[model samples]
Target: MLLAMALTLWSSIFLIIKVGYCYVNLSRKKGTVASQSSTHEGAFLASRSIDGNKGQTYRECSHTALGHSIAWFQVDLGGEYSLESVKIYYRNDANWCPYRFRQFYLDVSNGSAGSTTTLTSQRKRCYKDNTTALATPPSVIDISCKETARYVIVETTYNAQEAIYLNLSGPVLEICEIEVYGCSVGRYGESCSRCHGCSTCDIISGACQCGVSFFGPNCSNACSVYCKGNLCNNVTGSCTNGCEIGYYKDKCKWTCNPGCKNGCNRNSGSCDNGCIDGKYGIECYDVCSVGCISNCERMTGTCMCKKGWQGEKCRECSPTFYGPSCEEECSPHCYNGTCYVNNGSCIDGCTRDYTGDKCTQGLYETSPEDHGTAIGAAVGASIFVVIAVVVGVVTLRLRRKRDDSSKAQKDERKESRIKYEKETTYVNRQDHSLPGKDHSLPDSHVHLGKRPANLKTQEIGLYEIMDSGNGENKTYENDVIAKTVAPVTNTSNDASEENGNVYLVINESQLNSSHYDELHVQN
Candidate 1:
């Protein structure tokens, strides 16, 4: 029954199995082809694609209609296969290059529009050999698609019967055989058992190519517990981006000591920033005072002892050490060399010469060392207080000096101003004999007490007068102009109105029809 079914396929090849389509299917499943074939309606039926028939005779071939530019034949493989490659065999009965299939595409789908996918070539050989005439038959095309699908479609173009376009009778699509090669069912290779999702497995040997984290024969073994998320290199079991936080060692087998911030260096186990909980020193070996408010420095464990406590380990100061820092000694008057650390009170009896608890009086003789220490402390405190006061006074004085300097600089940069006085200076009409000399223009604008050569006269406009008042018409950087202001009674001769350099701000109404013409002078 399998051989009979294979013979009826007529036109194309079937699955690239060892035998016929019957063997490829193992169980018969229906297929459909859509086209207008001149020979037989079902001649290019989809069943032929997997029939394993390579016969090239027209009577034994499968051909699609030449009326349309595109046609397709799809096959339901009954079950999804992780297809490896597609092998297509064209009719070999005669030279059919003119009607030979030229342009086409292959597509696959999971029976839904959203999942429809077009198969692409994995190698350069998937392209057509257009350099030479495709006159011969037995032409086969092989393509690969590492995808899973139950429906395989071959869409080809008929060239719209344009023979000369491709130097042939017309582009046509005909098939004689097809073969599909890939893993079988849910298993792969000769072992017949699944190699799982590992694509690196050696199918023949059932040995795994082993990706990160997995190891052993089939790459089935998970990474060691030390590995983060059980992930590591297959062979070395070493993490790639370094060990996860708090974990260390080559295999991340070791963990950081308790109370670590950013864990420790992989090999050295030293705290990255520093140890917490008052541990100190390079490797955190040195211990700080128990009374310390915070941890000590890393390099040295010298306790920044508490307020009341003194000493390296923050131990309470002894009677002999009595003072704020507990480095000073008690009075020599104290019997048995005993005195309170907080105060100078004698713990035992006082010396024969001493009478009070502190032995402040009497004829008691004191030790030179004790006396010198007391004198030195008093002197040191006095010197420190003097230095602090001096520093404060100097700081205040320097601040005041800075303020004074800033104010002086601002004063120097300010614009100078001079009040205008009524002047009788006027243009010397053609006859330069009698000059209007009273209250003349300031001498500043004259060169060596002489009238400037560039001086001229013209009617001054309102805007021009305003410009003069603003000092805009002044040509010199230090030039001053009257701002239409009255002169002050206290105006000193030392005002910036030195030299004959100044602008007049006469009223426009006063400037009416007078013989006095305005100066059109360019400074």
Candidate 2:
């Protein structure tokens, strides 16, 4: 019986040991899983390349048939724990991949050495491009474990042959840091006291309190004075109805008296008693009336006129002067020692016998018309002399005409006798002349160039010429011939007629004859 009992006790103890071993192993596995899965609070985890190269070491997963470039990273939670989310900070090296880890697999396991089970799997492209550098971090992926996870593993889906030699060949992806978080267990009371009963709370303090200008556990109550009446000092508890005496609105700080027109004290709202000496009015701007004089002090007072003036305010002249003053005397040219006070002048041509100052002097009597008649007689005598001179000129002209006619007749008879004598002498001497003597004479003398006496060489009037041409002709008057023959023409032909128009002509013969006649008439 004892042996059996010992055996039973030993078996029971063995069963107990076996149970203890299993429990310990299970606890260890759970601890390992928790350590692997629990993310570090506020800590960054970096995924670096083994070769320590830059962008060439990491790459983002592709989407072609397979996926983008793949990258793997793991986190070990210290103990058995539950986590609601995980975050990875990563930067893409390629420009094509900019989204975070949108498509990824999160694997969780029990312990340090156990199979991994994917807690969550996603297929969306997380990054836009992959030009990110390795120094950059990874993005976060929240995986709900619901109080069950411990170890966590990340797997990126990549395109087939997207990476060459474990480096990104298509687009590179980089990871600079990582962060993980776990939900708090109720065993330690509320995880955050500040947000205990509030839907939102302060992230740093974690206290259950209101935000600015608010109160109450859930930030539901607002302070009263801040939103109501006139401004009230929260700290001093003071209320203001209006601004003080000299102060205006807008915090009751500005002063007012400086702009008051009637000498007001702005601060006290009181008026000063004194008015400006020369001014009076609401603002002391009106001036008092003083008359126009150097000594007048009041604006409305009358002015004192000088020695010889009289009128209202001394503005009128004296009676003697009739101007602005009464100091002037009447002029001296008035009639018979009297003076016209208004105009200061003498009366009507100063009277016949009066002259000198005020027309009081006697004058000498004389008739002015007698001198005018004497001047008229002298002018008449001058006119008679001018008429006599004109008559004398006419008589002399008539006498000259008669003398010229008689002298011309006498010269004509003498010229005719001399011409007959010269012709007979030339004819009588012709028989006694030598044969060569005829050729020896000058050309002019040979052409019957003998001088004649008794040539009638007078300028005759047209009447005389017509009377001689026609015995008793009266076609033209004597005055007409004198006027017409005043101008003479010298021409090549002594006399020519063309189309019944007579033209006086002159040649060498006419010129010589006319010249000789002019010389003889002068002698």
Candidates' C-alpha lDDT:
0.52, 0.37
Over the stretch 359-386, how does candidate 2's per-residue lDDT look in tens digits?
5455663346566787888899889888
Q: After superposition, how far is residue 132 of candidate 1 from its true place, in Å?
A: 7.6
C-alpha root-mean-square deviation, candidate 1? 38.4
TM-score of each: 0.31, 0.20
For candidate 1, report its TM-score: 0.31
Count steric clashes of candidate 1: 19
Report model 2's TM-score to 2 decimal places.
0.20
- C-alpha lDDT of residue 167 in model 2: 50
